[model samples]
Structures are given as structure tokens and as C-alpha cells.
Target: MTKKQPKSDATRRRNRVDSSTRQPKPPKSDPNNFHGSNNHHFLAIIAVVFVVSSAISAFLYRRINHPSLPPSFAHQRGLVKEDVTFQEILTENSRVSENVTQRHFTNPVLAYITPWNSAGYDLAKRFCPKFTHLSPVWYDLKSQGTKLVLEGRHNADTGWMSELRLRGNAQILPRVVLEAVPKDLLRSKKQRDKAIDLLITECKDIGYDGIVLESWSRWAAHGVLHDASLRKLALQFVKQLGDSLHNVRSQRNGQPLQLVYVIGPPYSESEKLQAHDFGPEDLRTLSDSVDGFSLMTYDYSSSYSPGPNAPLTWVHSTIKLLVGEGGKSLANKIFVGINFYGNDYVVAEGGGARAITGRDYLSLVDQYKPTMRWQKDFAEHFFVYSDDQHHEHAVFYPTLMSIAERLKEARSWGAGISIWEIGQGLDYFFDLL
Candidate 1:
């Protein structure tokens, strides 16, 4: 495929301008919040706006611009350089010949998995059966290829150094995310910027993809975005921070393929789930902001009726909710999530809690596997019992059988599938996805 150069229109602007100049801070207002005497959006809208505008400017000026880049900013399109240690990892993983170092992960089975330390990587492979794990952070590459990687956390102290040692020549920590604090300087933008700026500069200088923020909601919305008092300070800090990595791909912590936010099943979730009411479009907006959305379809209703075997229609409708309601563009990006654990309740004389954990459920299954029989339900799975206490129970786990059931859903939905957390599944749950 040719590197298509988009045409330019009234090129009133140059794409070279960084986010600092773009996302302006909102006007100030008297403030009162937890972080007392404060107000403002944390990341502001500058980076987003600048990135979007650049695309536009690039298109409009494509046909007539000189050098393509505005001025001293022209560089060849090439692979984002990989960190030394991780480079060795890729080399080992990507080996092709029958050589000992032919490369373990050259084909790029999985793009990016999260919190993917050694254990996480092992567990993830169980569900993402076909993909090999790689670090999205340190594995810098400009274009797509068979580059498989997983997300790993890195603080200022370790950076990529420790990751390199642990992963050895097999796994690579290509990128690093500075999940640190100036503890002393957090309240002051100047202090915060200086701290963050230092990390960002190191990342760019050393060659990293970019930074992964502390998921936006947990980030800006925590009162910072709304505060009007210190908004300008916050904006300046963020703009400078963004500039440190605007051209960089992403802070490796975030994998490339968008996340499919698994919408918990409303019926089973009861009231514990948040955001269930958010329709597909709302989900789509959320999805657009990041990567994608996922619908969780685990049932605890019956052995044959449809809880574990949720009514085909319900499943179809849920998928439609995101695709049709949210628009196919967004919906198509949806990935379905399946349950990997069981729920059971041990009522305590009239008013006890009903949510029993996997450990307990396993015990019951063990004690009853000989005498107890369960029927699949319309939602997920269930075992019939009229305990002397009248308690209810649900069963699920990503055992071989459970995984088989999930695979059917992932393929049918035409979206990716991810288990809630690898921690919940059986040890060998991913033995075969």
C-alpha cells in the first residue's frame, strides 16, 4: 500500500504546532473542592484538538506544502526505536530459522495486553490463545506489523531496567510509564510539570511510544477538570507534558487495539454495576475516546434453560444495542466478555449476604459433583437447589468447557473476547482458548 499523502485546503495552520499551543485552559471561577482552592481540566482539550487539527491541516496542505513537515521537523517514516533490552527480547522472540535465537514472538500474535507482568502474560495467553505477549510500552514501532506485546507498569525508579532483567531475552519492556509523584510538588503545576517534564523528556530522548495516563476518568474528572481556579496552571502543565510526547505513539501502558469496555449484564449485576444504563452510543462515545467496548454475557440462571446458556435473542440484542444503537463504526469495535467465576449465596438466617465467592462455589461443586446436577440457564449457568435456607447460586469459570462456550460467543459477535481478570480463572484456564 502506498503512503497516501492527503491534500491540503485553506492551510491557515501548520501541523507542527504542539498540543501546548492548542488546548487552551477554560476561564477561571471561584473554586471549592476536595483538593481545596482549585479548579480546571487536567489534560485540557489541547492535545486532542491539536491532533485532530493536524490531520485536517495535513490533508488541506498535502498537495502544495513544501517538505511536508512545516520546517525543521521533517523525518523519515521509520520504526519507532526499541529500547536496548527489549530490542534483544524482540530479536529472541522474532527468530525465524530453526536457530536457538530465531525469535520467539516475531509474528505478533497479541498487540498489547495490560498489567502484563510474567504471571499476567501467562494468564492472558490462556484466553488470548493464539497471541504471543509483548510489551506495548518499550516496543516502539511506527507502523503495524506482526508485533505482539503486553502492557506492563513501570515507575520512575525501575523504568525499563528491572523489566529487562526479569523478561530476560524472551520478553521485552519496550516502553515505560511514569506512575510516580513529585509528592511534594503535585499541588503546584510548576513542580508537577517539572517532574513530569523530566520523565517525558527521558522517554522521548530514549525513544518511547508515549505515555498512558491514569485512565482519564480516574485522571482529570477527579475534580481537576471542573476546577476553574487553577485551570490555567493545570493547562500549561498538561500542554508541556503532552508536547513531550505528542509525536510519540502512546505511553506503552496502553495497548494499540482499543479496549472493549465490557458492559456488565444488567440482570445479573443487580445494582453493583455502574454505566449499564449507558446505551451503545454513550458507550460508543466512550469507546471513541479510547479503543472499543465489550459486553459481558455471563449467566447464572440455569443448566439448560439459558442463564449460562443465555437466550440467543438476549445476546443478539445486547450486541445490537452497541452496534445499531451506538453505530456500527463503534459497535464493530466491541469485544464480548464472558464470566470466569461462579456466584453462590449462603443466606444467613433470613438476612445473610448471598454473594459467595469462587472458592466456596468450588467446594460446593466438589462435594456435589457426584449427587448434584445443574441445568444451564438462559443467562449463564445455574444449579437448582431449594436449600433449607432458600439461597440462590450461580456457577462459572474459564475451565476448558467454559472457554469453549465463550469462544462461540466471541466468534459469533465478530468481536474480541477477554476474561474479566486472569486472576479469577482456573490455573490452566487458558490451557486452550
Candidate 2:
């Protein structure tokens, strides 16, 4: 240090100033200086390299794991399974439950649907509001009529019925019958009882709303339908069946079960030439046993005989005879069958005809462009058409207008009306209903 000289006031003040507080040194100009801007430039370069390297690593990893996929395809690859999840099922079930309570009709407008007709379900769904009950004709007995069998159908029918019930909120009562209640089974009371029990169990297990018992002969075991002993046994069997059905628990309302007994046209003693001839006593028992009875007012003329299936006058006369005896009070419990089918008779000597649907008849009418007329006496729409073979054809079919007229007659009788079969694609009839 030089000989110390008394410093000036400004110099002393400057020296007293704190070195820590001194202005930082201006960055050095050397590009390689550790404390210079070159350090910041180096750091930036390293950062850019790290970012680029990370992106490249991610891309390579994806390519290794999932080859041939674009960068944007990452999300789409994760969704592979295409099926309804439990969450979706839960939502649908909730929706169906909410929808089932809204019924369109209080009185039953029952529609009979055969299992072979898949199109029936579609038409049923479309015209669900017009129907209050849907009876799927499926269950039938073996030829001997001892055991119940599913013929021309599958177990999936139950599922389809359930679906129809759920979606349409219509009561689903399937039709059951002993195609020809075997004579031996009827003779053996034990066998008849077992069959009845099986029928009940099957109905309950399948969640059917009700059942239709259609037996050709009250006492099939008796060679004669009018045998007094056979008739007595049939009465007892029906009574037991009714009691058991009433006792079973119902999925709907938790009440007694619904049972329908389909009977042949009730005829007087003189008119009892038909196979199933049940006297007034038998009719009384039927009226007393089941919830309701259906009169099959069709098949008076079959394809074997070329004539009207259900003549209006004949049906009316039968109805009068049914109520003329002990069954007079059971009119309200009766449902008249509305046959949706017809026969086209050949004008030749054979008097043979083919079975045709209402739609089929309409198509024939369109094809042949026949001379059509409505018969007031028969209450049927008639047409005469010549085929390409130059053979004259006579067609007598029930049209929407005629069917409506018959329905009015049924309603006047304080009875219900049921369509013989659905899935005719009868939009005209569907709209009318």
C-alpha cells in the first residue's frame, strides 16, 4: 500500500460502500465463460435435446407395443370389445320398468300369435297399443296328448314372450292343449293329474300371465264324448286345475291366476254332430271352472270343404244356443273368436279351397283384379276371379269392414273379441283396432 494519505470524502464514502451490494459485474464477453451467456445457451441446448429425446422415446415405445398405428390412433386402439356393459343393462332395465305401467286399454283385445311367425312380433310391437293380451299358441300335447311338448317352436319363445310383455305391457297368456287328449291318459286319473301339475309348473316357471286349456274331448278316454262318466271326470279335472292355478303366486298383482278354456261352438242336442259335443251340463261346469271361455267360431268349413270358415248366421245361432241354457249368465265371460283366415274355393265340381290370409286374399284380389262384392247376408266380401288356367275361382273372405261389423256384434253380446291369429301384416285391420 502507498503512504496513506487522508482520503477525500467522496473516496471514503465509496470505500465504505458494501461489496455485496455492488452492482454485479457486466457479463463477460468470452463465449466460453462459465458465468456468461454461453452457459445459458448451453443449458437451452441441453433442454431442447432432452425434450426431443423424450418425444422420440415415446414414439418408439408406442410403435413397439402397437405397430402400424398412427400417433392419433392411441385412443381408438383402447376400445376393442363391442358389447353392452352392465351399466348399459342397468339403464335399460330401469327404462323398461318405468314404461311397463302405462297400459293403453283396460278391456282385453287378445291377439293369438303362432310361434312360426317371427313377423308377428314385429307387428305386435307396432300395434301393441291396440292389444291388451297376447296369447302365443305354442304348448301342445304329444299326439297321444299325455305329455306337454314344444312343437314347431323353441325355448326362446318364452324369452320373446317376456320381451313382448315387457315392451308392450300386455298380459301374455299362452295357449295349451291336448292336441287329442290321449284316451289312456284320461282313463288313468293319476296320469291326468300329473299332466295338469306339469302344465301349472311350466306356466309359473315361464312367467306366463295365464293359460288356455283347450281339450277336444272332456273324456277322451271314453270313446264317446258325451259319456256321462267321462264328462264327470273332465269336470273334476277342470275344477282342480282352476283351484291350483288360483293358489299359485302371480308375478303381476300377486293374485289368483287367469285361466281360459277354449270351447267348441256350443250346439243344441239336435245340432251336436260335431266331434266335441258338450251338453248344457258340460257348459255349466266350464262356466264355473275357469276365468273365461273362448268359443272357436271358426273352422265350420275347412280347406277340405270349400266354404266360409265362420258363417255369420251360424255363429250367431251358436251363441244363442250357448246362452239358451245354464250358460246364459256366462255371456260376459265369453270371447268370440275372430278368424283372420279365409278359403279360396275352386269353382269346379270338387268344391276344394286353399287357406289364405287376409293379406294373401288382398294380393290375390290385386293380381286377378276380380269382380268384388260385399255380401250382406253372409257378412263376407266375395270375389270371382279366373286364374291363368281359365278356371273360375270363388273367394269369400272377411275384410276389415266385415270384421269390424262382427266385432260390434260381439260387443253387443257383452263378450270380448279375440283375433284368431296375428302377423297377417294387416295394417288395415291394425289401424282399425
Candidate 3:
């Protein structure tokens, strides 16, 4: 009915406007909306990265802070779940009290370590801080044709030395046994010079701090000490070697090389001065030439006697004879030897004694359960046990008390202590040191 009349322009325009208003229009794209979606994606990425980074950081921290023992060391120690005794001992002794004060020694605390026992290697590393000098019984000076040869270079462990240095700044003075003929070496100045040069070269190349010359015993065995002239030559050779070593500077710290002389103790108080044994006079002669005099004060009783390894009286007398009266200054350079091994002797005809380690002692205690006796006079521990064969055996070993008493005596004299070996003793024995 409305279309019947003529349509006006305003009406047409109004209809068109209504149609346009009713039609759906495409929306405009908002930059802010796109930015919000991108932000959410970025946040999700950041969360994932943070989780991964945290895990990595945690792993690294554990590795650096709480490092486990090297697999090789564990293997060398024969560490297994079955060794309950060893494991228990390790667990008990390994935990050091942070509050406990470390023992300080007036003189150098020297320890001898051998390669035959893996225990020595482990103990040396664990107790690196306890020693001022570590003497590895490694090198041997032997006669090779016209030239002097230094053997046992292959036994030098650079990695172990580095680790020892890192743990504690202990000087690495390897024990050098003199296997060369005394007549050939001490008699000829040329040979002596060659030997000194060889030793110096080895110290420089292997980064050794010094050498522990063990020739007095060998010289005594070869009868060099019996001859007064030869003995004088031997002394001169030692002095020369020491002077040369002291003159040369170490590549590691530029410090002069130290020379330690190993000397044997007198057999008895009434022992005559036959020049066969290194005595107190030798100490005085070598006080300036050597850094320290490692006196072998152990082995007072041998396998034949089956007595204490070192009697307190004997040790006291030995120190007294060597240091003399008011000899505090000389005592400072003396490193009295302490035995860590024991002798197990069979109390029967044709029976002999055998050396044993702390582990062996423990096994004996477990199996035999013998009556362990502490001899106050000798300051040692001894026990008699019957094996499965019904054969009686006497074992004489150093107890913690004995070690402590010996240490006290040495300290009173202002003398340093030298452990004959670290491997043969119990884990707790080191506590005395």
C-alpha cells in the first residue's frame, strides 16, 4: 500500500541506510591483540628455558661441591661391598670434625709411602695435609756401564703429585736407594759428579722437591764405612750432593732443593764406634749439609727375638745419645723413625717370623681372638694366638698408646717424626700424628 504512492528521495535514502545498518561489516585488525598473543607465547618459552637452566645449574653445583672419589682409587683400594671391616674403618675415620684443631708440629712431619700397598696411596692423598714432606720409595740409583743411571722414573706420578700439592703444599722428596757400587761411585769424583747431575736433572724434570738418599745402609753393607778413608769419601760425596741440590733452584717454586739423609741407628748402647753404623757424630757432621737426618730408630727386635718393634727405653736412649745434652738445635733436624709394621713369629722349631700389615693384624684378632697384652715397659702391644694347625704365634705390633708415647718423647726433645711407612698402620694410627 505504501509503494503505491510515488517514492520520495528521502524515503529511498532512508531505506538504503536501514539496509546498510542491518548488514554485517568485517572487523578491523587490532595490533594490540596480536601483541598480547605474542606475549603469552614468549612467556611460555621463558618458563621452559628457566626450568632447563635450573636443572643444569643444580647438576653442576653437585658435581663441583661434593666430588666423589676417583673410580681408579676405589678400584685400587679393592673397595667392595663384602669388605665390611675395611668399609667400617673408612666410614668411621673418614669423617673429620670441622671443629677439631689440626695438630701442628715444630719440625717437618715426614711420611714414607710405598707403591706395593694401595692403602699408602689412599692414605697419602687423604692425609696430605698432615705431612710436611712425603717420601715416595720410588727411585733407585744404579750403576750402568760407565755412566750413573737413575731408575724408577716410570713410577713417578705427576697427577698424584699435583693432587698432593693442591691438597697440601707438601714437599715431594722421593726416596732414592743407592744400589750403585760404593767403590765405583764414592771413589771417583767423575762418577760422583755424574751421579749428582743425574739426581739434579731428575728433580728438575719430574718436579721433585728433593731426594732422600739411602746410601749409608748400602755403604755399610758394602764395607765402605769400615774403611776410614772410604767413609770420609762417602761423607764428602754426601756434602757435595747436598750442596749441589741446595744450589739448584726448583722450577715449581724456585726454592732450593732439599736433601734428606737416611741413617741407621746404633745396635746397642755399648756399641763401639766402628764407623759401620751412622751415629750421633754423623748427625753433627751432616746437620748443615742435609735438611733432615731420618734416623732408623725402629727394628730394635728382629724376627729371631720376637720382641717389641721399638722399646721406649731404647728409643729414649737413642735420642739421648744423638741429641746429647742441650742439643735442642740438633734435634730440630732429626726425624726419628717410627715403625708401623709388626712381626708375627711362630713359637716352634724351624719357625720364622713374617711381617704383617694392620689388615693382617685385624684378621688375626678376628680369627684368633687372642689375649692382646700391652707391655708398659716396652710401650707396645703383643698377642699369642694358635692357628688351625695348633701352632702358637706371637704378634708384636704398635698400639695407639705406644705411638702416642713415642710421639710425646720425640716432641719433648724437639725432634721431628718420620713414619717408616704409612701403609702398614691402622687408620686411627694417623690420629696421633
Candidate 4:
């Protein structure tokens, strides 16, 4: 009360700031404080994450849409790593054909018809004009001797004649599968010669355009030994058959009957997972003995597992082997197999898968509307989904894009292509042709 000594101006201001009722002091603002810096830092971090995520999503989209982006052809046998590109293949395809009238595909498009199935007939009627050759399964070698026997009713019926007529001048090369024959009979030169003669006579009598000799060890009960025998006899049969068939003009058209040999995958001798009798030497021999060779590149992973019908990676590997110096000479005459079907499995791991045609697969996709994704590593499309009971299913198949990549590979190597079973393909499948 000592008359609250007259306060100084500075003392009055300090008192005002300290007093709660004094104008409610304005808050302090510091640009370098912890809360302000922390907020700015968080905003900066968020911006960086957003940019990174957007970039990753874009990259994945590009990869999935265009799976056939050319890889380093460095290890691929035929092309120079730097020179080969997808653009180059497209250009080659567009190059003018020798027949100035035609600028279409240069390679032969062979369609395989399983005569036992009605679908084959439908495929023949629908796609006959599009194919370069129609290979109808007609004959199978007998177990008793190297005898050619009719496979099914279609072989003996006049229906094949009408079907052949629908081919629009396409070659009618009946496929003669050497599957059920005894290895011993095939090994015996006398029996092999008899069989070759019989095949030629039957082909001439039947008015077929040509013949395709298919040898599969799995089709026969014999294991490695049987494969070995067939492998040895394959060259003999091919050489004899080619010499005999080509020398004898077809009674119908007076043209040299063409001969083709369907071989197993071009695996190196070391990898013997499947029973294979043919080796590099056998391949070369067969190549020498036939008008051309068709490598069975499909069925790499069939109903055995939930996997791609034909993985592009493996197809590339097979291409490398065939186009390599070892099999280079056979490149032009080679025809790689393509599957028009897929495999559907109960699980992605171990289970018996069922064959699904391209058409059937599309219908299933529509029905289930499952989650589908492009498998980048394999260069194939696969999907996973849960059923009503929550049972997961996986389906893998080829799309037009994937098949285009394969065709590119074949074109790069100057090889032809053949569909495993024409009936399984979707109608649009022929559109690519």
C-alpha cells in the first residue's frame, strides 16, 4: 500500500503479460520449434511415399500388359543380343513374300485334328481355310509288328474325305502315331521296312496329301528301354519312310508325298525327367530324313499341376536349343507346338489338373469372376479364386499376347508352328493366324 510506488512503463507491461485478465496474451509463434518442424517433416515424407507408390504401380501395369517385352537375347542362340528386338520380328513378318500375291504369314500353320472327337470336325470346318496344313490323327502302329492300323471310325469312314475337301487346298497330312507298337518290332529292320512299305501304300491308296510320323515313348508301356529302341528305330524309320514316300508319287495328284516327324522337347541329354530316346544326334538324323520336324513343345506342364500350358521362359529355352549351332540346320524345317488349352487345378501345389479349352476357360472366368493376374516371371496369365466352399482354384492359360510372343520367337528362328489340338482353341484363336 506504500502507495504501490508509481510503476514504471516496462514494469506495467510485464505485469500485464503475467496477469490472466490482461488482454489474454497472444500465443508465441516460432518457425524452428519441434511441433512445426515435425509437421513439415511428416508432410514431406508423405509426398515422397505417394510419388514412389505411383511410379511402382505404373511400372507393374506396363509389365503385365506387355509381358513379351524383349529380354536380353544375349544367351538366345540365333540372334545377336543387341540386334534382335520385337520390332525386328514384326518387320520380318511384313516383309514381302516370294509369291508377290501373298503378304501373309510366311510360316506354315499346322492344325492337329483328333478325329475321334466331333470338335475336331468343327475345327476343321471352321479353320480349314486358315491353316497351311491339316494333320488328322488317322493311324497308330500295332503292338505285334510295325503295321499301320486305323485309329478310329473317322479313319475308315468317308467323313474324312469330306473334311479333307473343306481344307481349301490345304495339305491333308494324316498323322501316324508310332505309340503302341512294340519296340522290338520297330528295332527289327525287316519289320520296320515292312511297316514303312505298308504306310506308303496305305497313304497312296487313301489319297492323303502327306504323312506325319509321331513317336511318343509315354504312349507306350515301355520305359527308358522302349524309348531307346524307338529312338534308334526312329532314324531308320524316318530315313526309310522319307526315301520310300518321296520317291513314290501320290496316285491322286502325282506329287511327292511330304513327310514330317513329330519329336519330343529338345532337352539336353542330361535332363531325362521324361522318358526320351532321342538326343541331339537323333534330332539331326530325323531332320535329315524328313521334309520337316515338329517339336512337341506343349504339355510341359499339363494336367500334372496347376501351371501354364507352355511357359514362355521354357519355350525360349527350347528355341535356344533348337536354333543353337547344334540344331541350326533344322530351324527352317522345325514346327514348334502350341497349346490351345489350359490346366485348371484344385490347388496351386499338388493335385490332378483338368484340361480346359480356351473357350471353356473364358466361360469359367465369366462365371466365377475370380481374381486374375498376369504371371510376369512365366509370361503367362493365371488366376486364383475361392469357391462356394472356400476351396481355392488356380487356372493358367495363354492369351493372344502370349501366343504372339511365341510366334515371334518361332519367326525369329525361321520355324513353323502347330497347334496341339485345333478343336480346343477359341474361334478368335484363328484370328491370330
Which of the two candidates, 2 or 4, achieves a greater TM-score against the reference?
4
Residue lDDT tens for model 1, 29-55: 111111111112211221222233222
Q: Report the lDDT tens digits of candidate 3 across residue range 1-433.
A: 0001112212221222121221111222221221221234322332342333222342333334432222222223443122224234434433342322254344578998877665887788887877888998788898988778999999998999998888787899999888887899988999999999999999999999999988887787677888999999999899999999999887778899999998766643343444576766777787788999887777554333345667665666666666656776798888888887777765443345677777777777767665555544455667676667766567777665566666766776678888868887877666545
Any idea how many clashes model 1 has?
A: 64
lDDT by candidate, in order shown:
0.33, 0.54, 0.67, 0.55
TM-score of each: 0.42, 0.69, 0.76, 0.69
lDDT measured at residue 281 in model 1 versus the true structure, 0 to 100: 42
Report the poorest 10 consecutive residues by lDDT, candidate 2. Answer: 1-10
Best-first order by lDDT: 3, 4, 2, 1
lDDT of 4 by residue, 13-100 (tens): 2221221211211222121221221233322422342333222343344345543323222112232222333333223322221222
Highest lDDT: which candidate? 3
Model 3 score (lDDT): 0.67
The RMSD (Cα, Å) of candidate 1 is 21.3
Candidate 4 all-Cα RMSD: 25.6
Once fitted onto the true fold, the runs of candidate 1 whose alpha carbons sit more than 4 angstroms away are 1-247, 250-276, 283-289, 294-315, 347-361, 370-379, 384-402
By TM-score, how accurate is candidate 1? Answer: 0.42
